[model samples]
Target: MAVHRSRRWSFGGLALLVSAGLASAVLINTSDAATNRANAATVTTTTTFSDDFDGAAGSAPDSAKWSLETGGSGNGNHELEYYTNSTSNAALDGKGDLVVTARKNTDSGLQCWYGTCQYTSARLNTAKTFTQKYGHFESRIKVPKGQGVWPAFWMLGDDLGSVGWPGSGEIDVMENVGYEPGTVHGTIHGPGYSGAGGLGAAYTLPNGTSFADDFHTFAVDWSPSAITWSVDGQTYETRTPADAGSNKWVFDHPFDIILNFAVGGDWPGNPDSSTSFPQTMTVDYVHVTTSDSGSTSGSTGGSTGGTTRTGAIKGIGGMCVDVAGGSSDDGTPIQLHNCTGNDAQKWTLGSDGTVRALGKCLDVKAASHDDGAVVQLYTCNGTSAQQWTYTSAKDLTNTGADKCLDAKDNSSADGTRLQIWTCSGNANQKWTVG
Candidate 1:
């Protein structure tokens, strides 16, 4: 099990940095902070793995699917729980759920990093049974409530034994500390962006309803180009290589799953007088679906399904549609530049009806419908602003604005910014969908 850290995070483009032990985060770029959440339907997928915890009450999880990780070293997060393989710590409920409990017990005579063990809990993992590259990975869970209680569903790259953390990479699909009962986080950690500096975002329940009150779905749609996080089907954030600043994106390999209920970690602090013990995190199921080809199908409401086209999009003066500086950061200008065959000049026409490069979508600025609106590379939100239609005539049009992608001022020279204008079938608006 990989012990992770947390810190400053975001929701859309809003900045909210929180510190957890030695971790903290900084704002790197803009995201599509839409008031309305994305409800776009997804493409087809094939079930790859599933577990419903449907064994007899008090029974352990199927040995074929899970391995109990026993320890009291705090897993590097300063956690207070001494993990055990006993049924008292982890068992399947007759009601079709797996319950991992944390209890305030000293009878085990366990030794922790702080001396005597104060609590006992369970950490279950699929490290030996399963590993996958890219797809939709999800879990439905009901967390425990009380200060110092932490529940998380996450993954670590299978290369941990060789490359180690932040190098092997980690993805937190859902994580919650007791202090924030209505909120859960989704984060990713990699080189140059680990610990408190990890990039992530928060999703809070409306009307302040606690997650402990019911089961909720937390998931991430992962592909070679981007990772999108959603809570109960509502998309709250998406991260691409651009969001990593200048750091390398290390999520292109296989990873294994982890589920744990911790107590008194560095992020949640020590359990206090008001805290309750014997807290249990109930998991309804863990399900994963993948694209047969090893990458996720394009997002919803764009192209139905087709082979991805990657190359340069040639326009007037034979210049290519390029991302400024080859940066994946949101708001990076989409312009016409001399074909250098570099990553900046590379564009992918996805089956999702979006044009992309550097892990971002070609977006219409602010979802604007007005002519002369700037076009840039932003997070893929499956919104009309990010959807494009490539016609047989080689015209790249924004579906929402219904405008042709135009070269500003009809200039063919390099560094010409691209914009959306009323369709005119002019040479500047014509493009080759590479």
Candidate 2:
């Protein structure tokens, strides 16, 4: 069994090499045009999440979608870098890239497992912002060079705090050790099959090209029963339960995405004189597309499995969603009102992803997708503009606009109009569909 190459090391400082044979696992390349189309036609996909790093240069990652992890505890891998929340270590490039840099530590005075921190880098995760079960998660990254560097794009089960470590499951969508310039690995860790024993395969680029030479896409198409790895649109290996070696398959639950660059660890040894300072991992973009067959537990307003749930949508300040003047007209304003249990406040989460009151559908005015688009009660028309999804996070989103149903100006006054706005996971956009 290969020792898990990158993780919080817990084997009493045991240093083992990942079996060279593991790299020999068969690569199921799908570079053929026919194969690509056939694979694409099998599943209908929808964009669920994306981050293009389009912010101004030196700006921090979006707080609504990513959180920086700061520490020097070696992340259980005996790494030498002190992870910092500073933009000096991670920030947008303005040219649409998230640059994560690892530089020689100077006078920060940060301590590491080895007494003093020798490097400074950054690590970011989406644990608080988002989590998804089965989807196509991908990122385009240009890796850095140097023997002691380690860059990874991965995910951990959302229940990590509860179950802990390997029990919580890990999916290493892509990991590259600086020494292995031409190859990347994808692995999964869980109970009974963790660390070096993780199930996955290594993929090497054709020719003698080094990954550090340019950007390349790394992705995983995850399903309930399997996870397929790919590079630059080329399908590689796929892992399934049968490969778990009798242990349980734990990838069925939601997981949060993580990206980081490390310096010196159990897998990639300490930097030597030949190693360079200030290595960086440049990320072009990160995207996750959900499958039509998959279920997003925290997704807002969508079909309720054919069940029509009639109730009041209690929102901020405990106000219920209401239709102005209890009207059934084609364009009646939707508002926040005191819970009166009247027809104007009664709503039904229909089987077709429609929210209705008085036979009128909750809709985005003029089918607009702009922020602050007015939300109104319009005659049911079976159109995308009328579709809404209620997520576990209490967000009621207008599907056509891909925005959350928000209380205008964050007000809860009796006639505060409803509007559609970017989902910021704020109190103004939260609702309880009872």
lDDT score of residue 420 within candidate 2: 93
Q: Model 1, which residues run further than 4 Å from truth?
A: 1-44, 293-434
lDDT of each prediction vs. the true structure?
Answer: 0.73, 0.73
Each model's total of backbone clashes: 3, 14
Evaluate model 2: give its lDDT. 0.73
- In the range 1-434, model 1's lDDT, one tens digit per residue, is 12345421111101111111000000111222121111111222355668999989999999888888776787777888888889999999989999999998767579888888999998887767776666567789999998999999888776676666667788889999999899998888989988877888888887889999999887776666677666654456677889888898988777777888989877877789999888999999998764322233221111112233556899999999999988878899999999998878766654445676765788999999999999998977779898775655566777687788999999998999999998787899888754
The worst-scoring run of ten residues by lDDT in candidate 2 lies at 17-26
RMSD of each: 13.2, 19.3
Residues 100-208, candidate 2, lDDT per residue (tens digit)? Answer: 9999989557988788889999988777777766666779999998899999998877666667778778888888887889999988888988887788889888688
> What are the TM-scores, per candidate, against the unseen true structure?
0.61, 0.62
